[model samples]
Target: MNAFEIIGGKKLKGEIQPQGAKNEALQIISAVLLTDQKITISNIPDIKDVNKLIELLGDMGVTIERLNKDTYTFEAKNINLDFFQSDVFKTKGGGLRGSIMIVGPLLGRFGKAAIPKPGGDKIGRRRLDTHFIGFEKLGAKFIYDSKKEFFNVDATNLQGAYILLDEASVTGTANIVMAAVLAKGTTTIYNAACEPYLQQLCKMLNRMGAKISGVGSNLLTIEGVQKLGGTEHRMLPDMIEIGSFIGLAAMTESEITIKNVCYPELGVIPDVFKKLGIKFELKGDDIYIPSQKHYVIESFIDGSMLTISDAPWPGFTPDLLSIILVVATQARGNVLIHQKMFESRLFFVDKLIDMGAQIILCDPHRASVNGIDKKYKLRGISMTSPDIRAGVSLLIAALSAEGKSTIFNIEQIERGYQDIDTRLRALGAQIKRIEASAPTH
Candidate 1:
């Protein structure tokens, strides 16, 4: 275990490029197992989750060539289909939520796949019912009991059928999409997660000869290809990272530039933050965050309070709610943050409240943050990192606090973002990565 110690109340100013998205990289890595030809992916983030998936792929005998930092070539000339029931599942799978997707491709190509209870943030009960439903629709059968926490799936001949997922579960949609790409006939997936990550996955599959229609929309039509060829692809920059940097610059009141952000597909991020009174300039693909002093919450013409919440694709992502909540603490007015996706996400507001923030946890999924502006400043406090987004949000909060702050349970943080501390440190953030406790000699 490791912790981040940060000395706060300093202006962090500089240019920092966020690594490739961890969520996208996970699916990209898993897609390698779908083909036997060479697949070259560049700008891959070297984060913990990606590394763990890479390790799992290696265990399956996927040949990998490290071209250089942030780039890798993968060829699955001969993949090891023997995914044994070993300590590997318990020790590794629980840490990676994306490991659950491996079951789809494995079952599609090899007829049988078993994944340990997939691990991820403990934010709430993110259901896998949709995943199982889609798998079952595609001629696969799943066997799992939550009490014992075991998962396995098998399908001899994947005859494609229509899959209407209960909810557009991101990983679930991805898993089904991967499996359906090689099925016997066409597969129609409705209510699919069309986030940029899923879009990239579809595009990659399409480039590999899979017929896919509607890459960025909820309705996806897939005509199974007999075989997929090796195709090179690059991942889109992380939307959450884009949102985090925007919130960071706003909170720190620093002038910064974020490069290579895809503007057309930002999906309400700019407009959502604009509602919070955070302003920035867009030059081509780069975003310029100027040093802002007074952040006033934009009131509606009706003269009521402002409320922001998350929704599905083309909607504001739930991942950035924590970051937005943290930055809103220093703004000039009040705003309500409603995180509808996951339960227990707003629970971290207690830590921010302890740091002299004016916040009221409305419920498990909602919080009312009353901004303090420059009149009050947050002081350092010790806290635990509960999940990925919450952990990074706390880090931002700690950085803007008055004194030194320590954050434990940071392995959760590493699961999503890549080298967050190092990137922040490069921009004058006083943060240090240290062990949680010393080992006995």
Candidate 2:
């Protein structure tokens, strides 16, 4: 394992660039399998999860070329269908939550797909029933193996039909749409997830000759096509990273400029941060956060305590709630952080409380934070990161704290944020990665 030893009390004051969206990259990378032609993708993040997915695609005989650090060309001309049934396939596809998406394209083109039980952050119970259920609705036969925790779907001929998803799951919607694009007829998906990632996916699919309407709404209509062609796609900036940077600038009292944010697509992220009284200016596509002595948390109109909560897209995202909770620790006044989607995500407040923040863990899903407003800096202490978002929150807290802090299990953070330590270092933050010796049994 590796750990980050951070020297706190550094106010970062430089320009940092947000990498390509990780969530979108997962969907787009998997979409490469939908076509046999060469597709070029720009702004792909070099993160652990994405690289794992890319490696899996290569193993399946996708011709992949690296044009640059952030660019790649993929052509799925000669896929090995027999490879999906191998033991190596189980190990490769079972470890990533994003691997579930491959099922859509494989079933669309090859008429069958199989995947082991997927793995990801243990923040909450992430169910795969939505993906399977959507596939079943699209004329695919779904089977599950309880002993092996594996799932298989077979459909020789897919016929489009109307699907009302139980919930607006992001990956689930993307998977179904990818499958529907090559079906026989029209497919209507109600209550779909309309995140920018989904929008970009729809746009790219249209460019490839798939007919899809309702690009930025819950109701999406798709007319199945015979085949899809290759097209180049440039991913938007990572919205979660941008939100984290905004909170980092506020907590550390630093003036930082985030370049090339692709502002219009951010959708309610900046406004949500503004409610926390973080002062920022939007100059062209860059977000500039100015250093301030104190930022006061704003309450509701009726004088009730301000509550920052997560919901579906166009609402606050659950991913950034941890950053919001950590930022609230140093703001003026109190606020309630509610994480509705995931039950265990808010449990990390215990570590923050130990670090000298006044936090009340109301339950498994909600916490109340009383901001110190810089009356006293947080005292750094040793901690372990439970998940990706929480790890970034702890890193931000440590950066604004008083002394040295060590965060173990940084791999959780690296899975999402590309080159995090190096990026923070570029902004004048004192964070170092130390390699630890392997333990012998």
Candidate 3:
């Protein structure tokens, strides 16, 4: 148990750089297992979840050499198949949702893969049905052990086939693509997730000799090859963090420049923040958000309350809804925040309400925030982080509030953001990390 003590009402200045995409890194790191040669990756975030996956890979005999803090070269030539049967494998594999993706490359190169049920943010029901169904479509036998809560997939002689996903699941699409890259025939995936992460995955696979088309579209075609060689990859900056910084700048009336954002890859994020009346200038690839005394929430064309919701790629991401909700707390008007992807994510509004923000939790999936409009500054209180996105949202709220605020369970925040307090501190934020006293059993 760790916590952050933050003194709010101080404007954050200077520049900050977004870390490499966490979701993309997870998928790309898993893809490293597909080849035995050295695959070098740069711009990797030094975060907990990524480190956990790296440790899991090392335990499985993948040769991991750290070229630097943010660069690593992995060689899976000497993977220990027997390690898959160990308790350490099951325990570590079940710790992060991203670990489920290893099944694809494992089944492709080693003929079988097994994992305990994967864990992640408990905001909603994140099912693995899409990943398994796609694997079964590509000639894999899927089995789940009821008693042990483990899943196994065996594809000794995989042959590609057509797969129309029930929904466009990002990890599901990435998993299936990795599996299909080394299969025996052509594969077609319809309604596949085409997020930039998936596009990067497709490009990296292609660079390694996998023939994949429709790199950034709903339909993907793959001509499976006998094998794939190693390649170098650099991950895109995390768009979700960029969105959070935009919201933070507006909330605190801070002039902050986010650097090297890879502007073209940020789809619908800037527009979504624009809807909240945030003003930012793009200088090449940098996003400069100037300080503002107040920002007004925009209404629909019909003068109705604006609604900020999430959709698949080409639409606003669900990950930033929490930041949007928190930023709206100080905006000039009312807006509806709909988190369509998750059912439990909006419950954190109670903490914000306790801190003097006017928010109505409409239901499990929606929240109505009546902007304080800077009429009065929010007063801080003690609260615990609920999830990754919500944790950062709370941190933003605490930074903008008037008094001192303490946020507990900060590990949830660190799982996503890399040294968030340290980074924010560099930009003039008053945040300190304090380790909690040991718990007495």
- Using lDDT as the measure, the top candidate is 2
**Candidate 1 lDDT by residue in tens digits, 292-383:** 98688877789888898999877889999999999899999999999998988999999999989999998998999998885877899889
The better-scoring model by TM-score among 1 and 2 is 2
Runs off by more than 4 Å, candidate 2: 437-441
Superposed Cα deviation of residue 52, candidate 2 (Å) = 0.4
Model 2 C-alpha lDDT per residue in residues 1-441, reported as the tens digit of each score: 899999999888999999999999999999999999999999999999999999999999999999999999999999998898889989988888889989999988888998999988999998887888888888999788999888878978899999999989999999999999999999999999999999999999999999999999999999999999999999999999999999999999999999999999988999988888999999999999999879999999999999989988888889999999999999999999989999999888888999999999999999999999999999998888899999999999999999998888899999999999999999999999997543332
**What are the clashing pairs of model 2?**
none
> For residues 1-441, could you state the per-residue lDDT of candidate 3 as single tens digits?
689999999998999999999999999999999999899999999999999999999999999999998999999999998887899998998888789989999987877888889998989898889999999998899788989888877899989999999989999999999999999899999999999999999999999999999999999999999889999999999999999999999989999999999999998899888888899999999999999998899999999999989998978888999999999999999999999988998888999999999999979999999998999999988888989999999999999999999898888999999989999999999999987642332
**Decoy 1 TM-score against native:** 0.96
**Top-down lDDT ranking:** 2, 3, 1
Clashing residue pairs found in predicted model 1: 94-119
Whose lDDT is higher: candidate 2's or candidate 3's? 2
Model 1 ranges with Cα > 4 A deviation:
145-148, 436-441
> Of models 1 and 3, which has the larger lDDT?
3
Predictions in order: lDDT: 0.85, 0.93, 0.92
For lDDT, candidate 1 versus 2, the one ahead is 2
